[model samples]
Target: MKKSGMSLLEIVISISIAVVIFIPAMNMFSTTGQAVFKTRNFSFANSAARRISQRLMAMPYEDIVEVPLPGIALFDAPAESFFAPFLNTSGTNSGAKNITQADMPEFYSYLVQHDFRYSLSVSNVSFGDGDEIKSVGILITWSENNKNMMYRLYVYVPSL
Candidate 1:
């Protein structure tokens, strides 16, 4: 009598070959997923930075100046005021001067909940012809997979 089905040894060899091919394919899929996640996070950070920059540019020239607030570092005052509109209240003096997670708008709180932090700074810089302009910088930082990532954006607001 002749057996028509595959032998036990043949079945074992086929399974081993399938595993060898399957391992690499599964690894590739996992790597692709990680890359996509990182890219999405990066895109969100970049958009946040740009939005902050645009807000800075739209402010009046005088409002963008770094004012020295007592017991606080320079530029802190203007930075806080710059973000004041996005706070829960309409007035700058409605609450604490410092920006905390609680002071963030709904959209910003959403970003914060996702582990993102941001900072805004404006400094005076001299361009060609000795004209002084306000250079606004926005920095966005986030953590991903135990790694820290940052994105920075700069915009110059000329005197009006």
Candidate 2:
């Protein structure tokens, strides 16, 4: 008698091969998805840093001085530890100076809407141009896949 259908052994072998191929394909897809997410997050953080840097560059050269204004605070308190030195806390107000969302409502709102936190600081830097140049640094932080990620940007502004 000729068998018109696959034997049980053949059927089992085919199923096993399919499962082996499927598992690795599924894993590859998962890894690709994770990589895509990380790239997107990095792009977003970089953009935010650039935006803050542009704002700093737009300010008058003298305004880059570290001033102690009361209402300017960091978006995240923890960031203060890493950015204290660059902070400009020596200008006018002396009442608990901090950089808060209120300082730039538009920036703050955009960050909040995207679940990001940022810190901006300015410091004196001599770029072979005496004391006429200032350095501005912006740090943009966000969480991705339970990991903390940060993007940093630095810009030099001249007294022009």
Q: For model 2, where is the 10-residue window of minimal lDDT?
A: 67-76
Separately for all candidates shown, the number of backbone clashes (residues 3 or more apart, or on different chains) is 0, 13
What is the per-residue lDDT of model 1 for residues 1-160, given as tens digits with 9 covering 90 to 100? 9869999999999999999999999999999999998898889788867766776777667776442211121112244444443445434456544344444455445454556666657788766685678876776777688887777788888874
Tens-place lDDT per residue, model 2, 1-160, is: 9869899999999999999999999999999998987787788678756755666777667655443322123344443333222245567444333334545466555445445667656777564645567776676777666666667778888775
Runs with alpha carbons beyond 4 Å of true place in candidate 1? 1-8, 65-113, 126-131
The best candidate in terms of TM-score:
1
For candidate 1, the per-residue lDDT at 153 reads 80
After TM-score superposition, the amount by which residue 88's alpha carbon in candidate 1 deviates from its true location, in angstroms, is 13
Give the range of the ten consecutive residues with the poorest summed lDDT in model 1: 67-76
lDDT of each: 0.65, 0.62
The TM-score, computed over Cα atoms with residue i paired to residue i, of candidate 2 is 0.57
Can you give the lDDT of residue 109 in candidate 1?
Answer: 51
- The alpha-carbon lDDT assigned to residue 83 of candidate 2 equals 24
